[model samples]
Target chain A: MTDFAIDLKDVDKLYGGVFSRRVHALRGVDMRVGRGEIFGLLGPNGAGKSTLVKILMTVIRATRAMGTVLGRPVGNKPTLARVGYLPEHHRFPDYLTGRQVIEFYGAMSGVSRHERRKRAAELLDFVGMGKWADTRVRGYSKGMRQRVGIAQTLVNSPDLVIWDEPTDGVDPVGRRDIRQMTVELKRKGTTVMLNSHLLSELEMVCDRVAILVQGKVSSQGTIDELTVHRQRYEIEVSAGDSHVDAGVRKALAGWLPDGALEGRLEGGQTLKANFDSPHLPALITVSTADAQPVQPIIDALRNARLTVRAVKPIRPSLEDLFMEAVTDPVTGRTLAPGAKEGA
Target chain B: MVLRQTLAILGDAYRELNAKKMFWITLALSAFVVLAIACVGINSKGISVLWWTFPVDVFNTAIVSPALFYKLIFIGFGFKFWLTWAATILALISTASLIPDFVAGGSIDLMLSKPIARLRLFLTKYATGLLFVGLQVMVFSVASFLVIGIRGGVWDWKIFVAVPLVLLFFSYLYCVCVLIGIVTRSTIAALLLTVLFWFVLFLLHSGEQSLNLFKLNAEEQTATLEARAEPLSDQIAKSKAVIAQLSEAPTDETAEARGRREGELATKNASLTGLELRQQSTAKDLESYRASLGRLKLWHDVLFSVKTALPKTSETMELLQRVLTSSDETSKLEDAEQQRREERGTRRRDADAAKRDADNEADRGGPGFSPSVVRRQEEINRSRSVWWILGTSVAFEALVLAVACTIFVRRDF
Candidate 1:
């Protein structure tokens, strides 16, 4: 088993005063994320996803409970050194150029000046922002800024990277590039904690995911485990005339000797046998004037004695799993997972 | 590590100052102030009129060049000092929005996620504020000197010393405003508080001067009684009779007292009545005098008991020292050792007080200003424009910044 990079136990976060009103951003969340794994936190708007990320980063303290990242307590400065973060609405000094921002963040993380310069170039290139590195961030587009945000996150070469809505404004191409980069980061043994509303992207990149609804984690698991209940199977068959059916019945005597035949008339001189389970293949017979035309196997079935139906297959998708997890099984109102359905 | 962190913080502060529009605005304001002052100085008619109103004879000293005299006049009147202080504070408040902006924009998340400590970031912003203030002061001094030299044809190198002192004063104010900015997280609130503080200090200084005048007038009037024909006993008897008669009548005290008290009693009654009319005037004046003696006691204590119950400067310093020393376990031990030295000094003072009390206890000495009277006299003598400006700015900024930082650091943002 891989080491757990981030472990949270019954963490709860309440914002605002103790006597006044508060927003229960995270309610008893328990999460254990494995090392070198891409874990996606999927939720709708105001679903406590960002709150969880903030708690992990120590930007917002958990009102009650315990958590650790990379063996250090959450919010520990030394631990922060091994962790990189990109907030949902990340903004840098507009006066600073892309290169300067990266260098500044690198310097803040205690990276040497020479190393910072080299890494800044490399990261700028990695984010496909090599040309725009020298240009001020004021002129950069949203997608470009998102790219720089990604670069900044990797500047520390942190063991764990937390990204909140990293692709909110990113175009499809940029999103794909980031997804590829995330996969690459995972390959390099970095644990990525991603908080995103984009389910499709999460499905593409995440090995496992947790869905939050109404300030609590509704469900969490691998995609396959979540969708196993929705699996299905199918079969197809052909039919033949009475004479051929009688011959087929004689041929199938050994396979289904005692079972009563269930038949349906399709067209002239045609019979189709249907069985539920543990059924065996049956035989057919045909007659013709010429020796070539006397081939019964094809002529009997093609002449409406027996004919094969079309065959098709289906499999459950991530969307199907998400819908099942989010929706109420009975009323289908998208209730929280594990909540009892109202009769 | 501290030095490195300080440097990083300084860099961060510099970056923040560079981004703020107030930095430029303050620079422009400083230039304008210097230019305005230079215009007033170059026009001989304006200088002559201004000097005529002041009591100083430096204005008439023939040895001093007109330009040198004008520079001295500017320094003495604190035109540059006030301008720099006001402009720096205004600019600092505008720049104070830096941290709040970062919080609002969610950039703090990215920043805090780095290895740098939060305090370092805070201190860096403060240092950057000072840097901006320093730049503005330099600009103002250089501009004022150039304007004066071209217009008044005078150049004295002594004026250069004033530049550093002015910058130092501005730095003190800037540090204070930055501290306020860090604490309050609202530039508007910080700015308002700084301005209100300056106004209150001005009122206090003016109020103290007026009270001294009234005290002097009372003293002079009391002196006249000794020279009058009436002996001390007869006058005392007359004062007692007037007090006894007035107790039975519901007459306006001012008119009654004026009619009864002839010379010394009249002056004493007027000053006493003045004290009674002003809220906490008597207690405050006494406390001010005591504080003015040597203890540096604040007037707030005399005016309001409940307010005084809150933490005072010594308590705040203790808390600050505790926070710094206890930041790490190893440093805490070192702090304990240093605290021992301070205890020794306190013990010595206690011993001295015990010795004095033993010797004086049987005497039952009449009421008088305590032994620290000399210290008080010195304080009163030393109280001047520069001292008032320095003391007021330091106290006001320190309090503002401390409160601001505490609130901002603890706040959710």
Candidate 2:
């Protein structure tokens, strides 16, 4: 079995005074991401996403935590050497130009001077920021800075890339480019751990995702697995004039005892049905005044006389699945306090 | 790995220093000092009156004159300009920003994450500070020498040796200031402490001198006692010779006889034993006061010198001990011994003074002396005690520095 690219077992983080005050940023957070997978950590603000990242990076110590990354203990230097991190709101030294910042970070990762220069050039190009490499970071716009931030993260060519709100403040175009680059990195066998509030962007790219709520893993799995509760199936049919109005309805009514049907009549004769079911496979008996072959039932639907007018399924999106996971079962409020609707 | 880390830290230090405007200010100040020294050397009137009084030997005039002058001036300047109130202020200002900047800039996180050891980073930064101070001293020394050479025509190569010694002293002082800056993390507090220390030292010196006045009074009493112990035989002979000459040459017989009798009476009074003389001397209230004053003064001088020397000696010994002891050694044997010696010396001096005071009381006819003289004696004693306390405190500061450095090296930072 492939080793976990990132793993945290029973991690806890406590802040503030020993008594009278405390903020449990993380309470027994358990997470695992497989190698060569783009894993999205989706959460609203203050959902412990940043805390988990900091613990993994060793910037903040975790209480009662044990974990490993790439077979080494989490936060180990060797493991860090193979990991690239872009913080949520990091500010590079203003005095240093984009090229200089990249070179410096590359050097810190133990890259040779010549290789640092080479990699810096290549990474800047990869992030579509080659032209502005000589400009000081102080002068860069938010989008430009985000681009440079990405460029710096790739300088080490790390085995694992962790980006915290990487596309924050980025324009839509820049955000799309970043998403594309992330996918490209994953294609190149680099594992990406993305922490973001952008659920739609994550939905477009992440192979698997975990929703963190109130410092714990609320739900985690592939998109398809999480939404298995909502099942769907599509059916096609053809019919004659008499069968269209009465027979189709009768058949659908018999087939779906506790289901909803939605479709349009293609012609005077053809009909299509869309159904939602708690379970599948029901008996259907149809009687028509005019008889029609099974081929005509299918053909009429394809042509104007029997057109294929509708196809609908009961599949739930990643958003619906996420909401289901984060919604507290007791109060029916979001597990993340102050989480807004549709967020 | 260590070398690379050290170089990186040094580079950071150098870069930071270069970026600071105070570095330029310090450079400008050093240049000004050198120019001032040069201008003074160029103008003959600028030479101190004291320097001109030193007798110039014909054989050594060319070398010794300039060398001696430079040595004196360098030593003076070492304690004056190089160790100025401004230098400490600058040191405090510069070093104070070192750690705070790292923390504020978030550079500490980046640097600490490296494989480099934290203590080594600290040491490298400290060494950079030393180097900066050394450069300032060297610049001032060389420029001053060049000016002096051109104007006074007294260029002695030996004078250059003062450069490193002065630099060493400044470096040590700056190191101490840096340590203070690290501990207190306040530039103003560190500078205030440095200034306060120097002011206290000045106070101690003045206090010590005032205490020495009692010793001078004692010397005066001894001289007076010797003068009062003249022989009666010589006085009687002189008196008889003067009376016979008056009888023979022209004076009235009645007047001459009266003069002779008076002289004879004075001679009889002068022919007293040492014990009787002391008794007679103490009978006079002034004489008794002088005797006690003398005893107080003698004890005061001895105790004062011991008090001043003991701390300095102990300080020097402690500095030596610090140099000799490895950081790993748990026992500070030499430092403990030095402390013991200093305490013992102080106690012994006090005991000796007490013993001498007791003896003086026995020798004096009685304790009936003027209040003013006694007050003066007490004042002298008080000043001496103050001096000793001040000296010990100064030496204690050096010991504090040693301890601070030791603790600093072990701190994780």
Candidate 3:
């Protein structure tokens, strides 16, 4: 009955027995997801992300747990009626069509037939899967299956919808649609807790994010609060016109070197992974949270006689924050080398 | 509401059964088997209701009455091995996946995470598996019920008991399968283990039964020996006591008393000698039985206990024969046929088999004949009440299911 939809503390899960090699999946982790907020769990592979969710759903038994889900103790069957979960590696029974699968899961949640039928139609449309409703899930592509998975998650109109890697194998467009769906869910005051390796997608939709590293939540807060510690201001000084001389471009290049631009030295934490470096765009987005003021960079650009295109304050992206949280400073070893390598 | 969810699971599972064409194929095959059985029927006039033979035997035609035909088909075929092994095995293979499929990776989590309790989910799924066999047997049982009425003009409702009876017997193996499937979550392993367990149990039961017959024979032999030896033992003891008393009555007595005492001693000694001879013969006769009695008792206790602890599968199947027919009518028909054969003066070699057929029918829920005559057919038979057979077997199945459910609940998906 608390304001939080999920309040879990000191949940520990161990995978094996004594006298055997045991895997510590979750280590006395304490977590809470606020009602109506989009909470993203950011973690590497084997970082205990799915384990934590599975524990809450009672799919995997925790060695120890002190928690309540939807205001009831974890593993409470009735409370699960109000909680929905879409597993990370979920697979629908192939014999059933998408609509039947949706309805079957809906019925399992005790949704009435009339309501299930109506919500199925609405949810399929909501997930942009209206056309594939009657098609057997065996015929579905990965993205289409994800769409159906999302649609089924809404069958009971759960108050707390938890999805693990909801857009893992989805196409870019499907990922955007999923993000919009979460936004809609939040707008309607539904608590959404999702775990995804797609930090950019999570950043676009997550109001708050928890970065888990090696069976522990290393950092968690609103995206802005966590990223504000390392903000970057970029002075995109391009030759405003292509006709600008090569001398001007060369002088501009000196002001904006193709190296780590020093923002303020607040703890001097270096990023272990690049952010938004897809295809290495011409636009150099620099973060100023670590080093000097933004005004100097701009003044330097003006002094170089370069036409300043635009100067924008750049906050650290979730990927940067994730890498910083999970990466070792000295060795620069990612918490999950395997997880990163999987991609 | 929980019940509703259980129903939903049952419904969904049944629909999943439809997802595989093999189930329908199995159902069709079962129906065809029943239809084939239905084709070979007998009428009240003792003629084949389906068709007559091409070259009808003009002379010495056998009389096959409706009652006889119905017994031959219903109890003889339906209750014996047709529905027991053939139909039950088919039903088993079709329903083997019911459990494994329910606990299949992604499916189990969604179902278990629902508002329903895990025990309920497990029980409902278990019931759904039973429904697979129940429906199959029901179809066949009802068809047989119809054939009994249509061909023999008797709507014996007892014939329909095979529906639940078949399910009860099938459950003996399915429970084992479910227990394994819950732990291993592999259909082939579960099924093979169940079948292997059954074969092992069957062999154990048969072995015990043979031992029981031997023990019973030893018991009967001991009783016969003891009966004969009892009279001789009394006579010999009395004669020895009389002779001792007469000798001790000695020198204080008068001449007449001594003479009478001598006469009595002579009579007692003579009788004693006769009794001793008979006693020795009886004791010699009893020795083999006494020796075997000890060994037989030990084996009987071991076999009997082992047999009782396991589910009573043979007795459970026997329920079909018990409920579906009567022994009195069979024995009466047996007598009438014997009388008719005697009047005709033709002693066929099949007479012994016909006598055995009647005895076999009489063996279930009815007192069997003397042990000596039925040795080849002793067969570790029991006249258990329907309740005892069904109740004990169901109890075993429930116990197995309980253990399996506990494991399933505790284990992580």
User: lDDT of each structure?
Assistant: 0.60, 0.60, 0.74
Worst ten in a row by lDDT for model 3 chain B? B53-62
lDDT of 3 by residue, B173-248 (tens): 8899999988888888988898898887788777776666666666777787799899878878877887888889
Best by lDDT: 3
RMSD of each: 16.6, 14.1, 8.2
The lowest-lDDT stretch of 10 consecutive residues in candidate 1 chain B is: B309-318
Off by over 4 Å in 3: A234-312, A336-343, B43-49, B53-68, B223-285, B334-382, B385-388
**Rank list by lDDT:** 3, 1, 2
For model 2, how does the per-residue alpha-carbon lDDT over B1-413 read when each residue is reduced to its tens digit? Answer: 35544554555466557766877788788776666554432122224332343232221233224434443444355325453446545655665555444433234444433334445555666677665655666666677567557655666454455444444444444545555666776666655665565455445555555445544455455555545545333454564565455435334457777677667555544543433555455446446657677676676666566546423322222232222223333123324434444565567567796665544443332253323344465444433443354346456545655665565544322
Error in Å for residue B410 of model 3:
0.8
Better of 1 and 2 by lDDT: 1
lDDT per residue for candidate 1 within A49-89, as digits (tens), equals: 87788777766667886767898777677778778889998
Off by over 4 Å in 2: A17-20, A230-309, A313-322, A336-343, B42-64, B68-84, B105-413
Query: How far in Å is the alpha carbon of A235 misplaced in model 3?
Result: 5.9
**Model 1 TM-score?**
0.65
Clashing pairs in 2: A238-A297, A300-A306, A301-A306, B218-B294
DockQ of 3: 0.53
Q: Is the docking of candidate 1 incorrect, acceptable, medium or high quality?
A: acceptable
Give the candidate number with the greatest TM-score. 3
Better structure of 2 and 3 per lDDT: 3
Model 1 CA deviation exceeding 4 Å by range: A234-315, A329-331, A336-343, B1-5, B28-58, B63-71, B77-86, B138-185, B224-403
In order of appearance, the predictions have TM-scores of: 0.65, 0.60, 0.79
